[model samples]
Target: MLVDDAVALVPSIPGRRALLGLAGAPAAGKSTLARRLVAGVNDRLGAGTAAYVPMDGFHLSNAQLDRLRLRDRKGAPETFDVDGYVALLGRLRSERTRPVYAPDFDRRLDEPVAAGLVVPAGTALVVTEGNYLADDGPGWGQVRDLLDELWYVETPRRLRERRLLRRHVRGGRTEAEARAFIASSERLNARRVELTRPFCTRVVSPRDP
Candidate 1:
C-alpha cells in the first residue's frame, strides 16, 4: 500500500514535525488514505508520532450556513471557514511544545465538534486531508506551501460516486436523495476538485504500487 511507501519517506524529512496534505474529491477516500498513512507511520515509529487533521472540521455551523444562504451547498468551499482552517494549519506548523487542538466533523450531527482532536507536543508528522488542499484559490494556495508534501487520491468516477452514495445513505439521506445530491451539486464540486490535481506533489491511485 502507498501508506507503507509514504511511511518509508518520513524519516528523511528534516524537522521535528512534518505536515503532509492529502487532497481528493469527495468519496475518493482522502480521509481513509490519511488514516492509514498516519497509522502506518505511528506503528513503525511510536504512538503519538502522527496525527490526522481533517479540513471538514472547518465547515461552518448550520446556523451560519443558513445566514449565508449556503445551506443547500453545504459541502462547497464557500460553506467552510477557510480563514480559520488556514490559521489552524499555521499554528500547527509554527507552534511546538504546547498541545494543538483540532476540530472534527461529525457526520451524524452534520456539524463540527470543537477540540475533537489533539496533536501532542513532539509529534513527528501531521497528516491533513481535504478536497481543497490542492486548490489554487487565495486561502487554499497557502495550504500547499505549509505542507512537506501533498498527495492526491484519485479513483474511478463510477467507484467514487458509488462510495459517495453509500456515505450519504449512512449519513441519513435516502438512496434517492443521495443520488440526487450527487447528480446535482456534489458532482460539480468533484469536477472543480479534479482541476487541482496538477497542483499536488504526487497523485495516488488505487492501481498504483
Candidate 2:
C-alpha cells in the first residue's frame, strides 16, 4: 500500500493511541518508512500526534552478546531482548498519562543506547519498525498481539543486499568483510524474517511512497 494511505488510516483507528508496526528484513527500509510515516502523521495531524519506537534499541549489549556467545549472530532474533521490547510496547499502549522512553541502537557505537526515543503523553499513534515483529517465536509472539497493525516492508533482494553492503561498509567493514557478514548473518536473519510475511496485516514496499 502507499505510505500516505497508511498514514491516513492511523487517526481512524479505534483508540486514543495506536501502535503501527513495520516489519521487514534488514535493509528493507523499515526504519526509513517508519520515520516517514511518523513525519507524515505529525504533519497531517500535529506535532506529538505520532512518535517512533524502534525495536533495534532492544538489541542485546555487546558484552551480553559476548557472554552468550551470540556476537557473530547479532541480528538474529535470539540476539535481542525480546521480552524487554514487549514490555515497552505494553507501556506505550497503556501509559497514556505519562511520557514513555525507549532505547535506540547506534550503528556507530554498535550498542543500544538507553532511552533514546520517547513517546509523549497523549500521542495518538506510535510507529515502530523491526525485523522480528511478525515472528511467532517465544517472546516475539507477544509483539504481534500488541501492535494494532503490522505491515511487512518488502524490497527486492538485490536492492536490499546493495543497501546492506553500503551500510556495513559505512560502519567500517571492508567490502569482503561486509559480504561475508551478510552471507553468514544478515542473509540468515532475512530468511527468517521472510517466513513471517504471511502474518503481517499488509505488505508495503519502500517504493510505495
The CA lDDT at 115 in model 1 is: 97
lDDT of 1 by residue, 67-164 (tens): 99998788888888888899999888866678999999999999999999999877777899899998887787888888889888898899999998
Give the lowest summed-lDDT range of ten residues in model 2.
6-15
* lDDT minimum window of 10 residues, candidate 1: 8-17
Off by over 4 Å in 1: 8-15, 206-209
Task: Encode model 2's per-residue lDDT on 133-156: one tens digit a residue.
Answer: 999998999999998899999999
Candidate number achieving the greatest lDDT relative to the actual structure: 2
For model 2 the local lDDT of residue 177 reads 93
lDDT against the true structure, per candidate, is 0.85, 0.90
TM-score of 1: 0.93
